[model samples]
Target: MRPFHYDKPATATDAVTNFRPGAQYFAGGTTMVDLMKLDVMKPARLIDISGLEKGRYDFIKWSGKSLRIGALTPMTKLADDDKVRARVPMLSDALWLAASPQIRNMARIGGNVLQRTRCPYFRDTSYEQCNKRKPGSGCAALDGGVTRHHAVLGTSDKCIATYPGDFAQALVALDAVVEILGEDGPRSLRFADLHVLPEARPDRETTLAPSDLIIAFSIEDADFPRSKYLKIRDRESYAYALASTASALRMDGNTIADVRLGLGGVATTPWRAREAEAALRGGPATEAQFARAADIAFAGASTTDENAFKVELGKRTMVRSLLETARMEG
Candidate 1:
């Protein structure tokens, strides 16, 4: 951590009011602080927003038709909520299967979704060819660097780093909307549109403005009782995913009435397999259909020698998630 000014605003409006260029909002500091320590990110000032809007933003509201979660709500709080687990189990499972218990206890949902990629090339400053770290420089990972953990989908020539978060995948599958309060006031955007693919501008990861403060996430029709988040990794616990899927399925006997799929660990963003979901919808809930849907999901995948296996692994993960979700009690 280099020398920087710190400010803790009393309210959300106050926090946005004090925002300036090169200033970063600090909440859980789980991801930001880690980067700051590594000198990967050096904001001129840090505005602590964790204390702001505690009563308003640090909450979880579940209406029968919808659910709204405060941005400041801790990962553990929402994951352990009986209502969330019973109704939208995918959301709970994603959070539960994320970082260790200590991290979940303090990590807020807003920051979790906005967390930076864990690419070694981007994090370690010694590597001088990271487009995400320094735009126009180039990507070291694409040039024969260790890419076992890099992305296989939504990858551009400029960057192949994967979005390393579980909760965002769940939100994408559920079509959650993110509410934002910026210097220009408030607005809402579809969660699916929040993260842009790393095309030419690899440094620009999210669509959020520098001063925009995420207020909360809202989801309409939050009644996905038959849902699951399945993650495959090198280890069983406390590890980043290699290929993961968040699946929510509604079955009409043996036929799929509705389906939603969000893929993680194999993509540059929280990936919504809309094509896969379309193929599964109104189809028989069987391994053959599931495999076909999986094929459609990875049809546009671009892979490297080190990470090419992600295509097959990602497909298998999605198929397994759908199978597990379909087996859930109605």
Candidate 2:
């Protein structure tokens, strides 16, 4: 691993105060540490926020509309928690789908949601031409490219990196909000807005500033009756998805009254398939209807030679999620 300075702060303010000069705030040390070890991230300093008071971590307040979660809360804790499992089974399943039981025990909810891109070229820094790793340096993936797992949505000529986390997919589907604590103050933003698309600047990954720490994510309670996580990968377990869907539906007397659909592994970030959702909002959840929505979802997909099959794969995966959820309701 690359050599770096490490600091542990007792409070949020203390952490913010110490942030700057190309430092990265460490929570679970899962992704960031891995990147540092791989030399993908070479920060001047590492501010360890795990030392912050554990009492500050909470998931209790169901005040009016939203549910608040603490940043330091473990993914396993959240997964096994009765409240989360009962309310958001889709989110629960996504968490359960990640890593192993051991890793999930150590990984924080905040870190999982704030994880980095999984581009092979970016991770292997020996290439010396990653736009994300070294800004303005040409991207090797663009020239020596076989972009089977590269980004499809929100990509640019500069980069086509894929966001490689499962929890963010659930967050986008639920229309969740991520809380960021910075040197200035705390702020809230929609999860969809948190991740930056590589439209122009492929170097930027998120809306977070240098000093900001992801505090937690909040999801408003929606009365959508059924939700499901359908992830298709090369294996049965402990693998990242090639095409996945996080879908929720509310049925009104044999028709779809409402729907929430999010795509994973098929794009740059947690992509909300609003066009597909809008088409099937009040339509019957029949085979043709589900297929039609899947078509709409994949309509705007801009894929290349390597991953063109993802368009069809994404549609089939979405349709399967809908059909399976509909059967479960019956």
- Best by lDDT, which number? 1
Candidate 1: minimum summed lDDT over ten consecutive residues — where? 48-57
> Candidate 1 lDDT, tens digit per residue, 224-303?
99998999999999999999999998889999999989999999999999988888889999999999999999999998
lDDT per prediction? 0.94, 0.81
TM-score of each: 0.99, 0.95
The runs of at least 3 residues in candidate 2 whose Cα sits more than 4 Å from the true structure, single-residue gaps closed, are: 58-65, 222-225
Candidate 1: regions farther than 4 A off: none
lDDT by residue (84-156, candidate 2, tens digit) is 6666678778889877887898888888877888888898877877888788887887777778887677667
TM-score quality measure for candidate 1: 0.99
- RMSD of each predicted structure: 0.7, 1.7
* Candidate 2 residue-wise lDDT at 184: 80
